[model samples]
Target: MEQRELGFTKIRLPVVGQGTWQMEEADEAACIDAIRRGIDAGMTHIDTAEMYGAGEVESLVGKAIEGRRDEVFLVSKVLPSNASYAGTLAACERSLERLRTDRLDLYLLHWPGSEPLEETLRAFKDLRAQGKIRHFGVSNFDQAELSRAIALAGPSEIACNQVFYHLLERAIEHRVLPLCERHGIAVVAYSPFGSGRFPAPDSMGGKVLASIAAAHGATPRQVALRFLLRRQPVFVIPKAARAAHALDNAAAGDLRLTSEDLARIDTAFPLGPDRGVLPTL
Candidate 1:
Protein backbone atom coordinates (compact mmCIF):
# COMPACT_ATOMS: atom_id res chain seq x y z
CA MET A 1 0.00 0.00 0.00
CA GLU A 2 1.03 3.65 -0.51
CA GLN A 3 0.59 6.81 1.57
CA ARG A 4 -1.28 9.99 0.64
CA GLU A 5 -1.26 13.35 2.43
CA LEU A 6 -4.48 14.33 4.15
CA GLY A 7 -5.76 17.70 2.89
CA PHE A 8 -4.27 20.60 4.88
CA THR A 9 -3.58 18.38 7.90
CA LYS A 10 -0.27 17.31 6.40
CA ILE A 11 -0.78 13.82 7.82
CA ARG A 12 0.63 11.07 5.61
CA LEU A 13 -2.18 8.49 5.42
CA PRO A 14 -2.60 5.29 3.50
CA VAL A 15 -4.99 5.18 0.55
CA VAL A 16 -6.71 2.03 1.86
CA GLY A 17 -7.17 1.83 5.65
CA GLN A 18 -8.55 -0.72 8.10
CA GLY A 19 -11.79 -0.10 9.98
CA THR A 20 -12.26 -1.91 13.33
CA TRP A 21 -16.01 -1.73 13.74
CA GLN A 22 -16.14 -5.35 14.91
CA MET A 23 -12.61 -6.49 15.40
CA GLU A 24 -13.33 -7.87 18.83
CA GLU A 25 -16.43 -9.70 17.63
CA ALA A 26 -13.91 -11.99 16.02
CA ASP A 27 -11.43 -14.11 18.00
CA GLU A 28 -8.59 -12.09 19.52
CA ALA A 29 -5.76 -13.94 17.79
CA ALA A 30 -7.53 -13.74 14.47
CA CYS A 31 -8.20 -10.04 14.96
CA ILE A 32 -4.59 -9.33 15.78
CA ASP A 33 -3.45 -11.44 12.86
CA ALA A 34 -5.71 -9.52 10.51
CA ILE A 35 -4.32 -6.22 11.76
CA ARG A 36 -0.81 -7.57 11.36
CA ARG A 37 -1.64 -8.60 7.82
CA GLY A 38 -2.90 -5.14 7.02
CA ILE A 39 0.22 -3.49 8.43
CA ASP A 40 2.45 -5.99 6.64
CA ALA A 41 0.70 -5.06 3.42
CA GLY A 42 1.21 -1.33 4.25
CA MET A 43 -2.36 -0.41 5.16
CA THR A 44 -1.32 1.94 7.93
CA HIS A 45 -4.47 3.89 8.73
CA ILE A 46 -6.91 2.29 11.22
CA ASP A 47 -10.23 3.90 12.18
CA THR A 48 -12.33 3.08 15.25
CA ALA A 49 -14.96 4.67 17.46
CA GLU A 50 -15.73 4.79 21.18
CA MET A 51 -19.16 3.16 20.77
CA TYR A 52 -17.89 0.37 18.59
CA GLY A 53 -18.43 -2.77 20.66
CA ALA A 54 -18.35 -0.52 23.72
CA GLY A 55 -14.61 0.22 23.32
CA GLU A 56 -13.57 -3.38 22.79
CA VAL A 57 -12.45 -2.64 19.23
CA GLU A 58 -10.21 0.18 20.39
CA SER A 59 -8.66 -2.04 23.03
CA LEU A 60 -7.92 -4.72 20.46
CA VAL A 61 -6.51 -2.17 18.07
CA GLY A 62 -4.41 -0.75 20.85
CA LYS A 63 -2.97 -4.17 21.47
CA ALA A 64 -2.35 -4.78 17.78
CA ILE A 65 -0.59 -1.48 17.28
CA GLU A 66 1.30 -1.67 20.54
CA GLY A 67 4.80 -2.09 19.09
CA ARG A 68 3.98 -0.74 15.64
CA ARG A 69 2.36 2.51 16.67
CA ASP A 70 4.56 4.61 14.39
CA GLU A 71 3.51 2.50 11.41
CA VAL A 72 -0.22 3.32 11.77
CA PHE A 73 -2.25 6.49 11.59
CA LEU A 74 -4.72 5.86 14.44
CA VAL A 75 -8.17 7.46 14.21
CA SER A 76 -11.14 7.29 16.59
CA LYS A 77 -14.35 9.29 17.04
CA VAL A 78 -16.35 10.79 19.89
CA LEU A 79 -20.08 9.96 19.95
CA PRO A 80 -22.70 12.56 19.07
CA SER A 81 -24.00 12.64 22.61
CA ASN A 82 -20.51 13.74 23.62
CA ALA A 83 -20.23 16.58 21.13
CA SER A 84 -20.03 19.35 23.73
CA TYR A 85 -16.70 20.87 24.68
CA ALA A 86 -16.52 19.37 28.15
CA GLY A 87 -18.00 16.08 26.98
CA THR A 88 -15.61 16.02 24.03
CA LEU A 89 -12.67 16.67 26.33
CA ALA A 90 -13.70 13.83 28.60
CA ALA A 91 -14.37 11.64 25.61
CA CYS A 92 -10.89 12.31 24.28
CA GLU A 93 -9.27 11.31 27.56
CA ARG A 94 -11.34 8.14 27.77
CA SER A 95 -10.57 7.29 24.15
CA LEU A 96 -6.89 7.79 24.78
CA GLU A 97 -7.15 5.55 27.82
CA ARG A 98 -9.00 2.86 25.89
CA LEU A 99 -6.69 3.21 22.88
CA ARG A 100 -3.61 3.14 25.14
CA THR A 101 -2.27 6.21 23.41
CA ASP A 102 -1.43 9.71 24.60
CA ARG A 103 -2.70 11.44 21.49
CA LEU A 104 -4.74 10.50 18.44
CA ASP A 105 -3.74 11.26 14.86
CA LEU A 106 -7.36 12.00 14.00
CA TYR A 107 -10.42 12.48 16.22
CA LEU A 108 -13.83 12.58 14.56
CA LEU A 109 -17.39 13.39 15.60
CA HIS A 110 -18.95 9.95 15.42
CA TRP A 111 -22.25 11.11 13.93
CA PRO A 112 -24.05 14.39 13.35
CA GLY A 113 -26.44 14.73 16.23
CA SER A 114 -29.06 17.41 16.88
CA GLU A 115 -26.46 19.72 18.42
CA PRO A 116 -25.72 23.05 16.75
CA LEU A 117 -22.88 22.88 14.20
CA GLU A 118 -20.93 25.62 15.88
CA GLU A 119 -20.99 23.83 19.21
CA THR A 120 -19.54 20.67 17.70
CA LEU A 121 -16.90 22.40 15.61
CA ARG A 122 -15.86 24.36 18.66
CA ALA A 123 -15.22 21.14 20.53
CA PHE A 124 -13.11 19.93 17.59
CA LYS A 125 -11.15 23.16 17.49
CA ASP A 126 -10.53 22.96 21.20
CA LEU A 127 -9.31 19.41 20.87
CA ARG A 128 -6.94 20.43 18.11
CA ALA A 129 -5.68 23.42 20.06
CA GLN A 130 -4.80 21.39 23.15
CA GLY A 131 -2.96 18.77 21.09
CA LYS A 132 -5.44 16.09 22.06
CA ILE A 133 -5.75 15.31 18.35
CA ARG A 134 -3.64 16.07 15.32
CA HIS A 135 -6.75 16.39 13.15
CA PHE A 136 -10.53 16.74 13.69
CA GLY A 137 -13.48 15.82 11.44
CA VAL A 138 -17.13 14.86 11.09
CA SER A 139 -18.74 11.64 9.91
CA ASN A 140 -21.97 10.84 8.04
CA PHE A 141 -22.63 14.49 7.24
CA ASP A 142 -24.59 15.69 4.20
CA GLN A 143 -23.38 18.31 1.70
CA ALA A 144 -24.88 21.29 3.46
CA GLU A 145 -23.80 20.10 6.88
CA LEU A 146 -20.30 19.36 5.65
CA SER A 147 -20.12 22.80 4.05
CA ARG A 148 -21.15 24.36 7.30
CA ALA A 149 -18.62 22.34 9.23
CA ILE A 150 -15.90 23.37 6.78
CA ALA A 151 -16.86 27.01 7.01
CA LEU A 152 -16.97 26.79 10.77
CA ALA A 153 -13.62 25.08 10.83
CA GLY A 154 -12.19 27.75 8.58
CA PRO A 155 -9.36 27.08 6.12
CA SER A 156 -6.81 27.09 8.94
CA GLU A 157 -7.90 23.70 10.29
CA ILE A 158 -8.01 20.33 8.58
CA ALA A 159 -11.62 19.17 8.86
CA CYS A 160 -12.04 15.89 7.01
CA ASN A 161 -15.44 14.22 6.63
CA GLN A 162 -16.27 10.52 6.87
CA VAL A 163 -19.31 8.95 5.19
CA PHE A 164 -20.69 5.83 3.49
CA TYR A 165 -19.51 5.81 -0.14
CA HIS A 166 -19.19 2.89 -2.51
CA LEU A 167 -19.86 1.83 -6.08
CA LEU A 168 -23.50 1.25 -5.07
CA GLU A 169 -23.61 4.37 -2.88
CA ARG A 170 -22.50 7.47 -4.78
CA ALA A 171 -24.75 9.97 -3.01
CA ILE A 172 -21.75 11.86 -1.61
CA GLU A 173 -20.70 13.00 -5.11
CA HIS A 174 -23.87 15.01 -5.67
CA ARG A 175 -22.98 17.63 -3.05
CA VAL A 176 -20.46 16.54 -0.45
CA LEU A 177 -17.70 15.76 -2.95
CA PRO A 178 -17.81 19.11 -4.70
CA LEU A 179 -18.03 21.00 -1.42
CA CYS A 180 -14.95 19.20 -0.13
CA GLU A 181 -13.22 19.91 -3.43
CA ARG A 182 -14.09 23.61 -3.20
CA HIS A 183 -12.61 23.70 0.24
CA GLY A 184 -9.60 21.41 0.95
CA ILE A 185 -11.40 18.74 3.02
CA ALA A 186 -10.30 15.25 2.17
CA VAL A 187 -12.92 12.50 2.41
CA VAL A 188 -12.57 9.43 4.57
CA ALA A 189 -14.83 6.88 2.84
CA TYR A 190 -16.24 4.12 5.05
CA SER A 191 -18.07 0.96 3.98
CA PRO A 192 -16.51 1.11 0.54
CA PHE A 193 -17.97 -2.33 -0.40
CA GLY A 194 -21.55 -1.54 0.63
CA SER A 195 -21.14 -3.99 3.53
CA GLY A 196 -21.15 -6.90 1.08
CA ARG A 197 -24.16 -5.68 -0.90
CA PHE A 198 -22.05 -6.22 -4.01
CA PRO A 199 -20.56 -9.56 -2.93
CA ALA A 200 -21.33 -11.76 -5.93
CA PRO A 201 -18.77 -11.81 -8.74
CA ASP A 202 -21.65 -12.32 -11.18
CA SER A 203 -24.48 -9.94 -9.98
CA MET A 204 -24.95 -6.15 -12.19
CA GLY A 205 -23.46 -4.33 -9.24
CA GLY A 206 -20.92 -7.00 -8.42
CA LYS A 207 -20.07 -7.67 -12.07
CA VAL A 208 -19.51 -3.99 -12.67
CA LEU A 209 -17.04 -3.88 -9.79
CA ALA A 210 -15.45 -7.18 -10.80
CA SER A 211 -14.98 -6.04 -14.41
CA ILE A 212 -12.92 -3.18 -13.06
CA ALA A 213 -11.19 -5.62 -10.71
CA ALA A 214 -10.16 -7.96 -13.55
CA ALA A 215 -8.59 -5.07 -15.40
CA HIS A 216 -6.25 -4.74 -12.40
CA GLY A 217 -6.29 -8.41 -11.27
CA ALA A 218 -8.02 -7.32 -8.07
CA THR A 219 -11.17 -8.45 -6.28
CA PRO A 220 -14.57 -6.78 -6.49
CA ARG A 221 -14.00 -5.25 -3.08
CA GLN A 222 -10.59 -3.96 -4.19
CA VAL A 223 -12.10 -2.46 -7.33
CA ALA A 224 -14.84 -0.87 -5.26
CA LEU A 225 -12.19 0.46 -2.84
CA ARG A 226 -9.97 1.76 -5.64
CA PHE A 227 -12.92 3.49 -7.26
CA LEU A 228 -13.43 5.49 -4.08
CA LEU A 229 -9.68 6.15 -3.63
CA ARG A 230 -9.48 7.60 -7.17
CA ARG A 231 -12.66 9.62 -6.64
CA GLN A 232 -11.38 13.11 -5.90
CA PRO A 233 -9.51 13.42 -2.58
CA VAL A 234 -10.78 10.35 -0.75
CA PHE A 235 -9.35 7.54 1.38
CA VAL A 236 -11.22 4.31 2.06
CA ILE A 237 -11.39 2.16 5.21
CA PRO A 238 -13.07 -1.18 4.52
CA LYS A 239 -13.34 -3.43 7.57
CA ALA A 240 -12.55 -7.10 7.85
CA ALA A 241 -11.65 -9.21 10.88
CA ARG A 242 -10.14 -11.93 8.75
CA ALA A 243 -6.51 -11.65 7.67
CA ALA A 244 -7.15 -12.64 4.05
CA HIS A 245 -9.99 -10.14 3.71
CA ALA A 246 -7.90 -7.43 5.37
CA LEU A 247 -5.03 -8.05 2.97
CA ASP A 248 -7.42 -7.90 0.03
CA ASN A 249 -8.55 -4.41 1.09
CA ALA A 250 -4.90 -3.39 1.45
CA ALA A 251 -4.13 -4.68 -2.06
CA ALA A 252 -6.52 -2.08 -3.45
CA GLY A 253 -3.83 0.53 -2.87
CA ASP A 254 -1.56 -1.38 -5.23
CA LEU A 255 -4.08 -1.47 -8.07
CA ARG A 256 -4.69 1.46 -10.38
CA LEU A 257 -7.96 1.73 -12.33
CA THR A 258 -7.87 3.40 -15.71
CA SER A 259 -10.02 6.42 -16.60
CA GLU A 260 -12.20 4.23 -18.79
CA ASP A 261 -12.81 1.84 -15.89
CA LEU A 262 -13.50 4.77 -13.60
CA ALA A 263 -16.03 6.23 -16.06
CA ARG A 264 -17.64 2.82 -16.63
CA ILE A 265 -18.06 2.30 -12.92
CA ASP A 266 -19.24 5.88 -12.37
CA THR A 267 -21.92 5.77 -15.10
CA ALA A 268 -23.02 2.24 -14.22
CA PHE A 269 -23.34 3.35 -10.61
CA PRO A 270 -24.65 6.92 -10.57
CA LEU A 271 -25.20 8.85 -7.39
CA GLY A 272 -28.31 7.62 -5.62
CA PRO A 273 -31.02 9.75 -4.00
CA ASP A 274 -29.84 11.89 -1.13
CA ARG A 275 -32.02 11.21 1.88
CA GLY A 276 -30.65 14.44 3.41
CA VAL A 277 -29.79 12.21 6.32
CA LEU A 278 -26.93 12.88 8.71
CA PRO A 279 -26.11 10.22 11.23
CA THR A 280 -26.75 11.39 14.80
CA LEU A 281 -23.34 12.57 16.08
Candidate 2:
Protein backbone atom coordinates (compact mmCIF):
# COMPACT_ATOMS: atom_id res chain seq x y z
CA MET A 1 0.00 0.00 0.00
CA GLU A 2 1.05 3.59 -0.59
CA GLN A 3 2.32 5.47 2.49
CA ARG A 4 2.18 9.11 3.53
CA GLU A 5 3.86 11.08 6.26
CA LEU A 6 1.88 11.64 9.43
CA GLY A 7 1.70 15.43 9.52
CA PHE A 8 5.28 16.79 9.59
CA THR A 9 6.58 13.71 11.36
CA LYS A 10 9.11 11.46 9.67
CA ILE A 11 6.88 8.47 10.32
CA ARG A 12 5.08 7.27 7.20
CA LEU A 13 1.75 5.45 7.50
CA PRO A 14 -0.38 3.58 5.01
CA VAL A 15 -3.13 5.61 3.35
CA VAL A 16 -5.63 3.17 4.78
CA GLY A 17 -5.59 1.79 8.34
CA GLN A 18 -7.70 -0.67 10.36
CA GLY A 19 -10.17 0.67 12.92
CA THR A 20 -11.25 -1.25 16.00
CA TRP A 21 -14.44 0.16 17.42
CA GLN A 22 -17.30 -1.75 19.03
CA MET A 23 -15.32 -4.99 18.62
CA GLU A 24 -16.04 -7.27 21.50
CA GLU A 25 -14.30 -10.24 23.12
CA ALA A 26 -17.03 -12.52 21.79
CA ASP A 27 -15.61 -12.10 18.30
CA GLU A 28 -11.98 -11.89 19.37
CA ALA A 29 -10.78 -14.64 17.04
CA ALA A 30 -12.45 -13.16 13.99
CA CYS A 31 -11.27 -9.66 14.84
CA ILE A 32 -7.71 -10.83 15.30
CA ASP A 33 -7.74 -12.70 12.01
CA ALA A 34 -9.18 -9.70 10.23
CA ILE A 35 -6.52 -7.41 11.69
CA ARG A 36 -3.75 -9.82 10.70
CA ARG A 37 -5.24 -10.05 7.25
CA GLY A 38 -5.17 -6.26 6.98
CA ILE A 39 -1.54 -6.24 8.03
CA ASP A 40 -0.66 -8.95 5.53
CA ALA A 41 -2.35 -6.84 2.86
CA GLY A 42 -0.10 -3.89 3.89
CA MET A 43 -2.60 -1.93 5.97
CA THR A 44 -0.13 -1.67 8.84
CA HIS A 45 -1.59 1.33 10.62
CA ILE A 46 -3.98 0.10 13.31
CA ASP A 47 -6.12 2.48 15.37
CA THR A 48 -7.94 1.65 18.58
CA ALA A 49 -9.02 3.44 21.75
CA GLU A 50 -9.31 2.59 25.42
CA MET A 51 -13.02 3.31 25.07
CA TYR A 52 -13.37 0.60 22.44
CA GLY A 53 -15.02 -2.38 24.06
CA ALA A 54 -13.77 -0.96 27.38
CA GLY A 55 -10.18 -1.77 26.28
CA GLU A 56 -10.93 -5.29 25.16
CA VAL A 57 -10.20 -4.28 21.61
CA GLU A 58 -6.76 -3.10 22.68
CA SER A 59 -6.15 -6.48 24.27
CA LEU A 60 -7.18 -8.12 21.05
CA VAL A 61 -4.87 -5.78 19.16
CA GLY A 62 -2.08 -6.65 21.57
CA LYS A 63 -2.54 -10.34 20.89
CA ALA A 64 -2.75 -9.87 17.16
CA ILE A 65 0.56 -7.97 17.01
CA GLU A 66 2.29 -10.13 19.55
CA GLY A 67 5.52 -10.78 17.67
CA ARG A 68 5.09 -8.43 14.73
CA ARG A 69 5.12 -5.12 16.57
CA ASP A 70 7.96 -3.87 14.42
CA GLU A 71 5.80 -4.27 11.31
CA VAL A 72 2.91 -2.07 12.47
CA PHE A 73 2.17 1.52 13.35
CA LEU A 74 -0.03 1.37 16.43
CA VAL A 75 -2.27 4.25 17.54
CA SER A 76 -4.55 4.60 20.53
CA LYS A 77 -6.45 7.37 22.27
CA VAL A 78 -7.12 8.50 25.83
CA LEU A 79 -10.69 9.29 26.79
CA PRO A 80 -11.39 12.99 27.28
CA SER A 81 -12.60 12.27 30.76
CA ASN A 82 -9.01 11.23 31.54
CA ALA A 83 -7.45 14.33 30.10
CA SER A 84 -6.08 15.49 33.43
CA TYR A 85 -2.31 15.59 33.71
CA ALA A 86 -2.10 12.78 36.24
CA GLY A 87 -5.01 10.91 34.70
CA THR A 88 -3.41 11.11 31.28
CA LEU A 89 -0.19 9.73 32.70
CA ALA A 90 -1.98 6.81 34.27
CA ALA A 91 -4.13 6.25 31.23
CA CYS A 92 -1.09 5.89 28.99
CA GLU A 93 0.33 3.22 31.22
CA ARG A 94 -2.93 1.30 31.16
CA SER A 95 -3.25 1.58 27.40
CA LEU A 96 0.37 0.57 26.89
CA GLU A 97 -0.23 -2.46 29.05
CA ARG A 98 -3.37 -3.41 27.16
CA LEU A 99 -1.64 -2.90 23.82
CA ARG A 100 1.43 -4.79 25.08
CA THR A 101 3.75 -2.20 23.66
CA ASP A 102 6.30 0.06 25.28
CA ARG A 103 5.31 3.11 23.22
CA LEU A 104 2.49 4.13 20.93
CA ASP A 105 3.37 5.40 17.46
CA LEU A 106 0.69 8.05 17.91
CA TYR A 107 -1.53 8.98 20.83
CA LEU A 108 -4.67 11.06 20.55
CA LEU A 109 -7.13 12.82 22.84
CA HIS A 110 -10.47 11.19 22.10
CA TRP A 111 -12.36 14.49 22.03
CA PRO A 112 -12.78 17.81 23.73
CA GLY A 113 -13.93 17.59 27.30
CA SER A 114 -14.18 19.60 30.54
CA GLU A 115 -10.43 19.28 31.21
CA PRO A 116 -8.08 22.06 30.16
CA LEU A 117 -6.30 21.46 26.86
CA GLU A 118 -3.09 22.76 28.36
CA GLU A 119 -3.06 20.05 30.99
CA THR A 120 -3.58 17.33 28.38
CA LEU A 121 -0.89 18.79 26.13
CA ARG A 122 1.52 19.00 29.05
CA ALA A 123 0.96 15.33 29.71
CA PHE A 124 1.50 14.58 26.05
CA LYS A 125 4.84 16.37 26.06
CA ASP A 126 5.87 14.49 29.16
CA LEU A 127 4.86 11.18 27.62
CA ARG A 128 6.88 11.92 24.50
CA ALA A 129 9.87 12.81 26.58
CA GLN A 130 9.47 9.65 28.61
CA GLY A 131 9.08 7.64 25.42
CA LYS A 132 5.61 6.37 26.27
CA ILE A 133 4.23 7.92 23.07
CA ARG A 134 6.06 9.02 19.95
CA HIS A 135 3.46 11.59 18.81
CA PHE A 136 0.26 13.26 20.03
CA GLY A 137 -2.89 14.55 18.32
CA VAL A 138 -6.64 15.06 18.77
CA SER A 139 -9.94 13.66 17.47
CA ASN A 140 -13.44 15.10 16.84
CA PHE A 141 -12.14 18.68 17.08
CA ASP A 142 -13.55 21.41 14.84
CA GLN A 143 -11.85 24.61 13.70
CA ALA A 144 -12.17 26.62 16.89
CA GLU A 145 -11.19 23.76 19.16
CA LEU A 146 -8.32 22.77 16.90
CA SER A 147 -7.11 26.38 16.81
CA ARG A 148 -7.07 26.44 20.56
CA ALA A 149 -5.22 23.13 20.68
CA ILE A 150 -2.58 24.36 18.27
CA ALA A 151 -2.24 27.61 20.21
CA LEU A 152 -1.83 25.65 23.41
CA ALA A 153 0.78 23.22 22.07
CA GLY A 154 2.04 25.06 19.01
CA PRO A 155 1.30 23.98 15.42
CA SER A 156 3.98 21.31 15.12
CA GLU A 157 3.16 19.62 18.38
CA ILE A 158 -0.03 18.12 17.02
CA ALA A 159 0.73 15.33 14.58
CA CYS A 160 -2.83 14.68 13.37
CA ASN A 161 -6.56 15.23 13.83
CA GLN A 162 -8.95 12.30 13.51
CA VAL A 163 -12.43 13.33 12.41
CA PHE A 164 -15.62 12.08 10.81
CA TYR A 165 -15.07 12.58 7.08
CA HIS A 166 -16.67 10.97 4.03
CA LEU A 167 -18.51 11.88 0.83
CA LEU A 168 -21.76 12.51 2.72
CA GLU A 169 -20.10 14.13 5.76
CA ARG A 170 -18.07 16.83 4.08
CA ALA A 171 -18.53 19.51 6.75
CA ILE A 172 -14.83 19.36 7.60
CA GLU A 173 -13.94 20.44 4.07
CA HIS A 174 -15.19 23.99 4.62
CA ARG A 175 -12.78 24.98 7.43
CA VAL A 176 -11.39 22.15 9.52
CA LEU A 177 -9.46 20.50 6.68
CA PRO A 178 -8.04 23.79 5.42
CA LEU A 179 -6.86 24.64 8.92
CA CYS A 180 -5.20 21.26 9.32
CA GLU A 181 -3.55 21.60 5.95
CA ARG A 182 -2.13 24.97 6.97
CA HIS A 183 -0.68 23.48 10.17
CA GLY A 184 0.45 20.27 8.43
CA ILE A 185 -1.60 18.05 10.72
CA ALA A 186 -2.61 14.77 9.12
CA VAL A 187 -6.37 14.25 9.02
CA VAL A 188 -7.35 10.73 10.15
CA ALA A 189 -10.87 10.10 8.85
CA TYR A 190 -12.81 7.55 10.83
CA SER A 191 -16.09 5.88 9.87
CA PRO A 192 -15.38 6.29 6.18
CA PHE A 193 -18.45 4.12 5.55
CA GLY A 194 -20.68 6.18 7.87
CA SER A 195 -20.75 3.57 10.63
CA GLY A 196 -23.10 1.34 8.65
CA ARG A 197 -25.27 4.30 7.66
CA PHE A 198 -23.96 4.32 4.07
CA PRO A 199 -26.50 4.14 1.32
CA ALA A 200 -27.43 0.67 0.06
CA PRO A 201 -26.05 -0.60 -3.26
CA ASP A 202 -29.39 0.06 -4.90
CA SER A 203 -29.75 3.65 -3.60
CA MET A 204 -29.02 6.69 -5.76
CA GLY A 205 -25.66 7.46 -4.19
CA GLY A 206 -24.86 3.76 -4.13
CA LYS A 207 -25.76 3.48 -7.79
CA VAL A 208 -23.27 6.21 -8.61
CA LEU A 209 -20.62 4.45 -6.52
CA ALA A 210 -21.50 1.09 -8.11
CA SER A 211 -21.13 2.42 -11.62
CA ILE A 212 -17.68 3.72 -10.71
CA ALA A 213 -16.84 0.45 -8.93
CA ALA A 214 -17.95 -1.63 -11.90
CA ALA A 215 -15.69 0.32 -14.19
CA HIS A 216 -12.74 -0.47 -11.90
CA GLY A 217 -13.90 -4.01 -11.07
CA ALA A 218 -14.11 -3.04 -7.39
CA THR A 219 -16.77 -3.07 -4.73
CA PRO A 220 -18.70 0.04 -3.64
CA ARG A 221 -16.72 0.04 -0.38
CA GLN A 222 -13.45 0.07 -2.30
CA VAL A 223 -14.70 2.94 -4.47
CA ALA A 224 -15.62 4.93 -1.37
CA LEU A 225 -12.26 4.20 0.28
CA ARG A 226 -10.31 5.13 -2.84
CA PHE A 227 -12.17 8.43 -2.97
CA LEU A 228 -10.81 9.23 0.49
CA LEU A 229 -7.34 7.89 -0.35
CA ARG A 230 -6.99 10.26 -3.29
CA ARG A 231 -7.15 13.17 -0.88
CA GLN A 232 -3.47 13.50 0.05
CA PRO A 233 -2.54 13.66 3.75
CA VAL A 234 -5.98 12.31 4.60
CA PHE A 235 -5.99 8.72 5.96
CA VAL A 236 -9.10 6.58 6.28
CA ILE A 237 -9.54 3.82 8.88
CA PRO A 238 -12.65 1.81 8.09
CA LYS A 239 -13.69 -0.94 10.48
CA ALA A 240 -13.77 -4.44 9.01
CA ALA A 241 -14.47 -7.37 11.28
CA ARG A 242 -14.22 -9.95 8.56
CA ALA A 243 -11.06 -10.92 6.73
CA ALA A 244 -12.83 -10.65 3.36
CA HIS A 245 -13.90 -7.12 4.16
CA ALA A 246 -10.41 -6.24 5.39
CA LEU A 247 -8.86 -7.47 2.17
CA ASP A 248 -11.50 -5.61 0.19
CA ASN A 249 -10.62 -2.35 1.94
CA ALA A 250 -6.90 -3.02 1.49
CA ALA A 251 -7.40 -3.41 -2.25
CA ALA A 252 -8.67 0.17 -2.36
CA GLY A 253 -5.13 1.35 -1.83
CA ASP A 254 -4.31 0.00 -5.30
CA LEU A 255 -7.43 1.29 -7.06
CA ARG A 256 -6.81 4.64 -8.74
CA LEU A 257 -9.82 6.75 -9.66
CA THR A 258 -9.34 8.85 -12.79
CA SER A 259 -9.97 12.60 -12.94
CA GLU A 260 -13.18 12.09 -14.88
CA ASP A 261 -14.35 9.53 -12.33
CA LEU A 262 -13.60 11.99 -9.54
CA ALA A 263 -15.56 14.69 -11.35
CA ARG A 264 -18.53 12.41 -11.69
CA ILE A 265 -18.41 11.53 -8.02
CA ASP A 266 -18.15 15.20 -7.11
CA THR A 267 -21.23 15.98 -9.20
CA ALA A 268 -23.14 13.18 -7.53
CA PHE A 269 -22.06 14.25 -4.06
CA PRO A 270 -21.47 17.97 -4.09
CA LEU A 271 -19.44 19.51 -1.31
CA GLY A 272 -21.43 22.37 0.19
CA PRO A 273 -21.05 24.98 2.91
CA ASP A 274 -19.85 23.59 6.20
CA ARG A 275 -22.52 22.59 8.69
CA GLY A 276 -22.12 24.61 11.87
CA VAL A 277 -22.58 21.58 14.10
CA LEU A 278 -19.45 19.67 15.09
CA PRO A 279 -19.25 16.05 13.92
CA THR A 280 -18.66 13.26 16.45
CA LEU A 281 -17.35 9.64 16.60
User: What RMSD, rounded to one decimal, does every model reach?
Assistant: 2.1, 1.1
Q: Write the per-residue lDDT of candidate 2 for residues 83-118, one digit (tens) a residue.
A: 999999999999999999999999999999999889
Model 1 poorest ten-residue lDDT run: 272-281
Per-prediction TM-score to the true structure, in the order listed: 0.92, 0.97
Please give the lDDT score for candidate 2: 0.90
For residues 1-281, could you state the per-residue lDDT of candidate 1 as single tens digits?
66787877666778988888766678988888898899889888899999999888888888889988877888999898887767888888988998888888888888778667677678777777888788888888787777677677777464588888777677777788877877778888887777756657666767787777776777877777877888557999888788999888888888888889888877777766777654321
Local distance difference test values of all predictions, in order? 0.81, 0.90
In Å, residue 34's CA in model 1 sits off its true spot by: 0.9
Pairs in clash, predicted candidate 2: none
Q: lDDT at 272 for candidate 2?
A: 75
**C-alpha displacement of 271 in model 1, angstroms?**
2.6
